[model samples]
Structure formats: C-alpha cells, structure tokens
Target: MNRLFPVWRRCAAVWVTGGLAAVLSVHAYAQAPTQRPAQSATQSPTAWTTSWSTALQEIPRIAEPPPLYQAPAVAGRTVRQIIVPTLSGTTTQLRISNRYGTRPLTIAGVTVARSAAGAAIEPGSASVVTFGGKREVVLGPGMEMDSDAIPFKVTRGAPLTVSVDAGSDAVMQAWHRIAGRVSYVSSEGRHAGDIPAAAFNVRFTQYAWITRLAVSGEHKGGLVAIGDSITDGLRSTFGADRSWPSELSRRLAAAGATPMAILNTGISGNRLLSGSVCYGDSLESRFEHDAAELPGVHTVVVMIGINDINFSSMPARRGLDCDTPHKVVSADDLIAGYRRVIATAHRHGLHIVGGTITPAALPPAREAIRLKVNEWIRDGRAFDGVVDFDKALRDPAHPDRLKTSFDSGDHVHPSDAGYAAMALAAEGVVPGAKR
Candidate 1:
C-alpha cells in the first residue's frame, strides 16, 4: 500500500477507472428498472395491459331501462334539444320525461344548442347530442328516457336552449311545476311495431328505459333544488320549461357554469317539520332520500315549510292525523329541525342555501307562522346563505300576502312570472358553484 506509483499513472487510475465504474452502474440500474417480463404470445394468446384502449373494451356495457304504460289516442311530443348550465368545459347529462302523459309517445331528433334570439328551429354550433343507436325513439305513456351520453362545454351559468317537436298534437308530460331531471313516461310506443324507447334487453336481461340523461364533461359539481309547490311550478303549463328550477338551470348554463342537475324533491304538501297533506313523508323525514341521495350534489336550495303551517290548520284535514283538532307547530320546533338537517349536510361538506317561507295569509294562521319562521330563517340563525323569497314575493301593500302581480289565482303559489322572480332571487347563490 505504501509503494509509490508514477504520479500521472496513479491519478489516472483513481479518477478515470472509478468514475467509469460508477457511471456504468447507474446506467445499468436505470435500464433494469424499465425492463418488464415479456410474455410469449404462443403461450398466453392475450396479455393484460394498462392501456386505455384495452380498459375501455373490458368495461361492461350499461343496459337500458324498462317501458312504461301506454294508451291509443294520446301521445307525448319529442324532445329536440336540451341546453343546461355546467362548469365550463365540463360534461353533463340530459333527462326527458313523459311522466304525466296519458299515452305512448315517439321521440326523434334530440339535439343541443346555444340559446338563440327567436328561431327555436335551427341547430347551432353549440349543439351536440346523440340518441340510442343514432336512431329515433318512442316513449310509452307515464314513462321516461335518458338519451345516449353527451359532452357539454358549459361556461359559467350559460343558457342552454331546449326544445321539442310533437309528432302529432301529442301533449308531453314533464315536471309541470318544478324544473328537474325526473319525468314520467308512457306504457307503449306510438304503435305496436314502433321502435320502443323503453325496452328490456334480452342479452343483458335488463330494462332499456332511459330514465336519466347524464352529461359528464370537464365541469365541476351540480345543484340540488329543494322546495315546495311554487318551486315545483304547479300552475305552469305542461311541457313548458317555466318552473323556477328549470329557469334557474337555464340561467346557470347561460353563465358558462356546469349544467346543474335539478333533483326536484318538492312534494305538493311537503312541510318543513311536519307531515304532508298528500300522504308522503315530511320534509324532515324525507330529507335523507330526496336531498342526501342525489348523485353529484354539491349545493341545496331549501324553500319549504308553508305547507306545515297551512295543512296543520286546515279544519277539513284535521281528522286525518291525531285526536287533537289541529297540529300547531312552533317556530322553535321548526328551527330545531332545520338545525339537524344543516348539521347532517355539513358533515358531508355541502353548502346549504336557505329560502324563507313564502307569504301565505289566505288562511290567516298559516300567514302568522310563515312570518315567524321566516324571521328566524332570515336572522342568520340556520342556513349558510339566505334567499328572501318572502320579501321578493310579498305584496307591497299587503305585506302578509303574496304580491298580487306574482300570485296565482290560488294566492298560495306564485304564477309563472312569480316563480321566475324567485329563481332570480336565489340565482346568485344557488346556481353558481366555484370550480
């Protein structure tokens, strides 16, 4: 070890030989890490790969839904286009319904487009949608259909133009009151031999009914609209997309936002804390199924509670419940119930926007409770945000009643125009969710 070598020879051995060995080791390991075990095609025939094309082919095909009821004389119209607000550059789904029609209906030529000035006939550059088998469809009475998938590049709250063409003088059954994705369908097609929109696949052994139209793209989460009959659009004409939620959905699309999927959980007699007159679950009891169960839900708009006060005080409906002549619920009880619902939603990180109970003085007692509860709801005691439906809809002269201009003949629910106003009130908070 002590023997001295020629100075230049010693230096060359230490620097050049050691550096070359280190470099060779590193290069060998890098190549080794990338090397994979090759399979023999003769032995395996097919080798598994992580490529996207192989994964797509391996996925199972989704079967269609079932057929609904049908009659001879009546029929529903065809949905031509559906435009919805979505997260800009996101994809979404569209739902078509005949839930209220009396007979079977045929559907053909479904498309999407940007909202135009007057012509509801032309397909615009913004339009792109496809049907099953790229062919026309037929919906049975009281049934629905979900079209083949579509990709939407939604801007923040852009206006999506939707239209339909009736094959005959057929009336389409849709969500008459509320704007949502759920709708009814008919039982049979236009004729026995017509291409059925709702069919059962023999190969897959599943119903081929298109109950939901889902559009998924680069958008963010969606919207869940919860409320009563006014939000439901009870007095609006059938097949007319005039409900407040529908209008709100349209407005959301116009803003270049993700098209919000409206899950209409509004029951005619739904209450805030108590049972309903229509024999369904109360708002409190039904919350789990209606609001919590919706897919892709990011926000909830709650505009209910008037029915709790109205139906409880109705003398004609008194005998249906308990021995007490009436069930008068206090504001405290309603607030407590709301707190529970809010807590549950917050656990899931959902933003809840509360809507004040609408003005309802027709029965007098109902009006008093509405005012009391709305005061608490507006006081920032319950929800994440407040939409003052009462102030927007209340009459200037008669503060206790709905505005005469906005009231339907019944005075309880808002007319189509009034619903539009409510839609505007919650527009800023309800429809716009950040990406």
Candidate 2:
C-alpha cells in the first residue's frame, strides 16, 4: 500500500512537477489570499466575515417541460419574501448572479428584514439594500454583484427575508431549485419593502437570482460541502433545513464546536469530470467559483462521482450529452479526478476531505466499481481527511447497498435519518471542531 505524503511534502511535489506558473494558475483560479490594505491606526480593526452560500443551479435547456416544475422562470417581478436561515452575524450582504443570462439584468430595488411569519416581515426591521450606495444596479451577462453591507443583527437559525425587484430587463433568471423553503413573488412591481404576503400572490419553492448571503462576524473559517443531489438535499423535506450540512451546522453550534459557516454547493445530477446543461458545471470546472473563491472558506467536504458511475451505464437522454451511454469509467479515472481536486485545494491552503461513495442498488459490475473507488479513497492518502459515508449508510448484511431503514426508497439517496447519520460521521473532521 502506498502511504500518503504529508500535505507540505505533497505541495512541494506539486510545485516541482507543475512548476511555479502552474501553481500560480491553480492558486489564481482558486482565488487564494492576496495582500490587503493595512488598516489605519485610527480605523477600527476589520471584522471577520463568513459567506454562507445558497448553492446555485443551472437552468436546464430542455426542449419539453418535465412532469413537475422544480422552479419557475420569472421576469418583471418582485420576489418579496425569500426566507434564508442564517448562522451568525451582526451585518449582512447579498450576492446575486446573472451567470446564465443572455442580457443585462436590472435590479429596481432591494430590501432585507427579519421574518415575523410566513411571508411577513417584522415591523420596523425592514432595511433597504443598496449597491455601492446606489439604489439600483445593472449586472451584465455572466456577472455577479454583491450588495453593500446592511447593518442588521442576524441571530443564529433565524430566517431573514430578502426581497428583490428584478426589472423587465432581468430575463432568464438563474435560480437554486429545491430551496426546501417557500419564497413569495409579486406581479411586476417594486414591493421589496412590503411586510405582508398580501402583495406577493405567488409562492415558489426555490430561490431566485440570489446566490450567497455573507455576514460579518467572528469565525474560524467556512465549510463547503460539494457533491451531487444527495448533498443538495433533494429527497429531504421541503421548507425544512434538514440537509446533512445544515444538521452538521446545528450540531456544531450546539456543541460549541469550531465557529465555521457551512456552505452547501451541491447540485442535483452533478458529476466530477463532466458538465451538463441542467446539472451545472462539473466539480473541476466550478470548484474555484463555487467553493474556493467564497469568503473565508478553509475546508471542503466532497462527495461526488456517483453520478459519473451510474450515468455511465445508462442510456443517453436528450439534453444530457455529457453522460454518454455505455461509457463506463475505471476506478483510476475517478481517482485521477479526486487527485486533481485535492491538489488544487492543497495549493490554495484549503483542506480537502474525501467522502467514500455510498453503496447503491446497482448491478454487480457497477457495485464493484464503487467498492474500488471507496477503497482508493480510504487508502489513497490524496485527501486531508476521509468521511466514510459508505460505512455510515451501508447495510452490514448486504454490504453493497444502503441499509433498508436508511434508504430513501430510490435505493440511492438517503432518508432523513441517514442524512443525520452522515452528518454525525463527519462531526469532528472539521478543523478545531470539538468532539
């Protein structure tokens, strides 16, 4: 068995093999730390901030509508009642994206307030959100804009309502489907300051336009969970924050463990090596933007590649050209992808934790491949740490399938109880986390 080298040694090897230019390129792509202006003696010290991202999803370019609508494409409307559960902060800011837009997106108005009830804001808690002191901002195609900090006390686990008036110019909005919460929308008007759900007639189960919520507070760093639909909380309950990452955050807070904001960057049907129109970019392609560049992110827990394996043996479907039918990948191919991610994380000084692929109800051939991959993850020493999700969710009797009680009926995704178990398995992998 090949022993894992120390992180420092691995970093040195990467520098020697790839050269300084390659190292610099990876670091730049990951947006590694740079020099910041020194604070003046008269000015107060900079406050620590943690960015908690509501993972972004790609709007599928489908020719036919699916059986159920996961998210609605809205234009010329005011999304008035977006409830986001936060961790800790004294002040808050928002990150909005037009990543997939073909034209400029205009924001007519924006506001943030504490939620009083369903679609209702606390009286006197409404605050106008501005961009660089401007009431409105225009974002071009494939662009993202961050709002100026709004002075608000954000209590842990409290929901904050963020309202935005996407003017008529805002078309084909990028949204995060499977919000697991309800958000209300208005009919082509600026009602961002509205306190009641009266004006907001339509309710949606996904978050629109907004991608990230950052808060200024003291924290050790941020934790990013990157993977596929399982990590995305697909089968999890709607309107309830029960994803393993969310549960893990609650556990950390309850235990008074390390102060780290958890950011879930999972997308349904996402793969490690390939991209699809509906599933967003591949892990390799979006890691920098989705996980690395985020503010104060120091660790990433990755659980990808299952789709890569499962989809390989499936028949090709329309709009999913990335997953070619009968294209089975060897364990080596998957391990190569993991190594690339690990190296990139190491170069950026972020600890990468590898997650063993959980067992699925696959044929013997595919199951064998999964076992190979998990074995490599356990003994490969490529990652800083390993979370044995396979062990956590697998049945002792079958050993190649999810436990009956833990299975979410699909034999792939985990039940709510299983998700909690997965979170527990990952409890102490986070740096500075108390056992």
Candidate 3:
C-alpha cells in the first residue's frame, strides 16, 4: 500500500535531467519508548497509569482515501487538540507515534495547558512537553515514543488543550478516527503557546501523532473498555462524555469506588478475528499493546464479535474492501477466540471480564449467532466475571432488538441513556463498584 516502503514517482529516472536538483533532507530523532515497560508489583509504588487514550489505525490504503482518512496537512501547522483525560494524574507523561507511517513524523514542540473553551486554553497553565529532555523528536515508520514526564495536574475528568507544532515537512499517516471530541488546527506556522486560540483556524476531530497520556501515581490500577464501535461510543453525543466507559468512570467517582482510570481502547470497525486496513489489526493480534501492556491496567472488559458476525454480509466495495476476509463466524469460532484472549490476559496477570453482545436488530440468521455467543459468554464461565450488556439494553418485549429508548437511531449503536445503562450494568458486576 506504499504506506510502509513509499513508492515514489521514479518512472522518470530523470531522462537526461539538466541542472535541476532536489534533495529531500529531513533530520529529526525520536526519543520515546515503543512500549512503556510494565512495572513489577514488588517495585516502588510510584508507577504510571494511563489517564486517557484512544486507539490508532493506519489510514485506509486505498488511493482515493475516504473523507475521514484525508488527515489535515500538518507539515508546518500547529494542531491544538482538546484531550479528555480525567483519569488520575499528578506527574504526567505523553506518548506519540509514527507507528504506521512511510514518512517520518516530527514535531517542533508540544505545549499542554488547561482548556478554557473551544480551542482556547487557560492563560497561565501552559507547560512544555519534552522528549529525552529535548523539545523536538522524529518518529520513523513503526515507532512510538513517550515524552519525558511533565509536572502537570490533570484531575478527575478535566479537559486539556494539547498544542503540537509540526516540525517542518512532517506528514501524518496514522490516526484515531472516532475522536468523539473536538480539536483544532492552525492555518500555518507554530502556535504551540498561542493561548488566545486565534491562529487555530482549521478544526477536526481525529487525533494524530499523540497516543497515550499517563501519570505516575500511587493510585489503584485502571479498567480498560476494549471492543468495536459500540464500545467506541459511536453515534453518541460529541464532546459529551457519553461513552459507557465514561459513564462507568462517573459511577466510580459517585460510588466512592477505588479511584482507577477508565481507559477506552475501542476502535470502530475493529474485529476479534479478521483484520482490516480500515479498522485496526484484529483484537487477537493487538491485545498485548492495546490492553495487556498498559502500565496500570488491572481489569479489561471485552465487547466484540458483532462485527465478526455481521461483516461477512456487507457487499464488497471495488476500491477499499474493508469487509474482506468476509469469513463468516459461528458461535463456536467466537467462543474459541474468547478463550484465547482470556488466556492471554491471564498470562499478563490481568483479570478479564466478558460483556454480552448488545442487541442489534439483525436478521434472524445472524441474530442466532449473537444469541448463541451471549449464551456461551454467560454460561461457559470463560472470563473472571461477566457484564450482561445485552440484558441491560435489550427490549424486554422483543429480546432480539434494543429497547426503543436505547437505540442510537441506527438500531445498533446505543444512545447516551443506553450507554449510561450499560455503565450501570457494568457497575454491578465489577466488584466494589456500587453506583
């Protein structure tokens, strides 16, 4: 896909070129960890726990990429993003990546400050973000780097304005598409410390470069909500913390449950079995990095397999066939996959929970698979615990469909209230969580 090893226009190997000359000279070095090494429990208590994060996907490789993949030009622009990181943090650190890029991604500088309003940051709260004690860093293909810890305070769900000034000639090639939050980009030039929000003219929701924000703390571990678009909180109200995981976070605070980060690692269209260029690597392939490898993740709740069951029916597109591997799945195949994931979590010494597939008004045949899978999830006792999301949002009258009040209108994704209900159901099952 010319994404990893770029295929340049070399057919014109300079047919008797005259005096013209062009040299692509870009030099920047990245200083960050590909993976934050897990802290041993017996070690010192001060460790890093991810405060907030979203999954990244290699942009769809098709020539005519979709509107969503048309990542805004960041070569010489400053992008100001409103990061929603309310998980506990005292001494915070950041992660950035060029994990799927052909061209190097470089940032001249990054500055974080308390968000005031749309694209506006609090005047005096700005702090510089450094890498290996330096301001600039470059990431080559398949690389992710974490920043040096910054002494900033991000409390329970407060918003943060992360301003990044792209190094000269940097290009973006990977992104987290369903940001479900608002962010802005400057027209041109560096605006990393622009507190007035005047230079940030362009706006977008997708997140680029930056990945995880972790805080070194003595707090309890976190809960990771990992799944498909439903878990991604798709179609939920934008800029509002309406995702089930967010709602779960709210409940934890209200109930006085042990304070832990509720990190969301769900990617829209992601599947448990098949891989897609559009939706990230299959969960079975990415589970380690996305879930098990995070610093202080103690529990993980898995809600997937719906896409694995339904994508087989989607008609193939001529260009980007995101539905490929159209490999139809049976209940047995999914149950086997779950067992593998469960074993992996156990190996990592993390407790894993299973969530029943929620209701989606599907045709009878496919619906059967979902029902059977949920049955196995409940009865098989594969996970350490279970969260019956289907029971929470399904219509009592129809069992096969979502409650009308819970439907996000497409009949698959959940509405805000529906997500809240999911959170409530999850609260009851996760031990000690009572709200």
Candidate 4:
C-alpha cells in the first residue's frame, strides 16, 4: 500500500538542509521576548488568532429516540473521570449535540472542576462552569450548540468534570467513552469567574446533551475519531481508560507532541450510511459535523460499516425482508461509501486514515460479509492510510471472528484490551500531530 508518511518524511528532511544554511548566516543575537519560533516553509508565519464560524448546522426538529430496546440504559451511571489534556495558552469550549432528541432540551448549567482523585472521579468533588456572559443554554429539539467558552489552564492527563444540568423532557443522546476519575469546579465564592478548585459536589438532576468539545489553543489542530460503538468503546469496561483513541492520545503525549487533542465522535449502532437502527443519518451524512466541524481538526480516523452489514442481515435472517434475501451487504456498496467519506475529508484538507472493520465472530452467514467488506477496506487505496484492526484482533485460525479473549461476547464490539491493541496499531498513522 503506497502511503502518505514515507513520502512526507522524505520531504520534511529536505527542508532541514535549507534551514541550517540560513541560520548560520543570521547573527542577530537579540535578547528580547519578541524571539520567534522557527517555521517550516510550508507553514504560515502568522500570529495565532481566535475566530469562530459555523462548520455544520444541525437539523433542528423533534425526532424519535434511538433503539433503547437493544441498547443499554445510562441511568445511575457515573463517569468517574474525564481526562481532558489541552495545549498551553488556550481555553476549552465544550460542544453538546442533540441530533436525535425527541424534544427541546435545556441545559441549566455546567461545571469544569479539577480532579482530586487520580484517574477516576469520586462523588461530591465537582463545580460549575461560568464566564462573563450567560451560563445557561436552551437547545431546541434536534439542534446542537456550543457552550460559552470556559477560560482555564490545563496540563496533560488533567482530571476534569463537565457535568451538565438537563431539562425534564430532555432525551439526551450521549456518546459513551471510558473516562477516568476527575475533580469538579466550584461556584463563584467571594469573587466571580475566579473560583478555585474545591471538593464540593456540584449536582445536576437533568439530562446530558454534550456532543463535542473545542479546546482553543495556539498550536496545531485536533484529531476526530469518527465511527460507531467500537470507536466509542462500548463493550470496553466502564470507567477504564482503555478506548483506543484514549490510548492513542496518551501515546501522542508521551511522544512529546504539542496540544494533540482527540474527539471521539462514535455513536453506538452507527453506520457509514443511513440506517433505521442508529437514530441519526449515516457516518457519511454526519461526517461534516462529527469530523470536520470541530474548532480545529487536522485528521480523521474512521472505523464503521459493520453495523450496516449486521442490521442489513437482520431482516433477512428473520425472513422479514425480501430485498436482501441472503442477508448480505455487498462489498461494492461499502467500497463506494468509503470513497465518499475519503473524498469529503480531503475536501476539508483533513488527512483521512481508514480503519479496517474488526473481525466479527458472528455466524457463518454474517462472517462472510465481514470478510468481504474487510478485504475491500484493506486493499482499497481510497484512504490515505489503513489501520488494520482486522489483522490486530482476528483469531489466527478463524480469520473472521475475534479471539475469544478479545471478543466482547456479542462478537461485534471489542473488549478493552482489544480496543487498546487496535489503538496501538493505529499509532503511526497520525504521529506527532497536534490539536
């Protein structure tokens, strides 16, 4: 597979020769704070500026809730900690989406607190999020909005809380990820907008509608992981930092990359194309908003299409539909859909890396479709690079279903260890890139 990195490395080395030649001749040793950082010829030499624009306008209409029958409930569930590592010299703005809500939702308020506990957060240690303007927001049904940017300084692996207060009728659609323990912020004490970290639990008794998070920084852009539950780490143990994307970020930080942010935009039961199962349109339909619309997204890694086959096969398996008698989703359709996703990302100047659908240890009928789809995804050059999750998780003997240990029992989503392996395999595809 002819790829992007090998060629990029060669091109980058050539500039070093030219840069050293200029550095030796310039002898202006001025000791001032106006010193500038070296910039590559291909890079722009402009001061960092804060600007806002609407990347995608979500459809604002009351719709139906997703398949709660098959999906698990989130009630009485608590995310111990959310690790939000940010670039220096910037504030983080959070984006909440309600694309699948059945009624208008109102977010009473939110809090960003510091974590006292390591990794996982304990109850009663979070606070509120506020700024100069209004703190509360009223989001209509099926609409997505951004919060008033919260100005705060953060370090790597900083445990934080983004607790939301939802309206009574809010049917909050949340993306499930295994966030570790974090501390919470407190309300304004003697001075407003200058609340220090405290151990008071900021409680909210409403629904949560947080879709995206924007960290404003004066460095490289961010990476958005767009796909289904696999990217969302559905079967991965709750409260464990095992999601591949989460592992990828930790690896990037260890590699000394500046401000590399990751936004996991995976929804359970989602597909690359529209489906009746996942409440919203296909990955192709939501690509613009989910992947490209973040404040700064430099790359996108996509792993989807499994649910398309599974759901498409469901009707035929039950002898309910006549269109797909064999209950098989053709590779040709999946390939075409991949091309559309790649082309769209390229249009936004994003480096798109395709992820192979992990081997599903399903019945023989479904396994055949999985193999065929994985074949096209692996060999297809439509993507800039391929993350071979199939190779990473498939059992050696079977070559279709994941190994028993890696399998999440349903044979669709991966276990925590399996997701970590996939993330480790995808490491180099987006190396040293910033957010």
Using lDDT as the yardstick, the better of models 1 and 4 is 4
What is the lDDT of every predicted structure here? Answer: 0.48, 0.72, 0.79, 0.53
Q: What CA RMSD would you report for each candidate?
A: 20.4, 7.7, 14.8, 11.2
Model 1 stretches with alpha carbons more than 4 Å out: 1-212, 255-263, 276-279, 317-326, 431-435
Model 3 clash pairs are 32-146, 86-157
User: Alpha carbon lDDT of residue 249, candidate 3?
Assistant: 90
Q: Candidate 2, clashing residue pairs?
A: 180-239
Candidate 4 lDDT over 205-304, as tens digits, reads: 2113444444544656566788877887776775565677877877777767665666576766667766433234578887866665444566678899
Question: Model 1: per-residue lDDT, tens digit, 1-435?
Answer: 101111111000000111121111100001011111111112211211100000000011113211221112224333322233423444444445554356676655454455443223224334434455443555666454444445554453445444333355564333222232322232323221212224211111111122232334323445566656666667765446566777776666566664456544565555666553232446666564445434355567777776666655565522234212246776677788888877655554556767888777645655666777788777644566667778788888998888988888787888878888877766666434331
Candidate 3's TM-score: 0.89
Q: After superposition, how far is residue 433 of candidate 2 from its true place, in Å?
A: 2.2
Best by TM-score: 3
**Top lDDT hit:** 3
TM-score of each: 0.55, 0.87, 0.89, 0.68
Question: Runs in model 3 with CA error above 4 Å?
Answer: 1-46
Better of 2 and 4 by lDDT: 2
The TM-score ranking, best first, is 3, 2, 4, 1
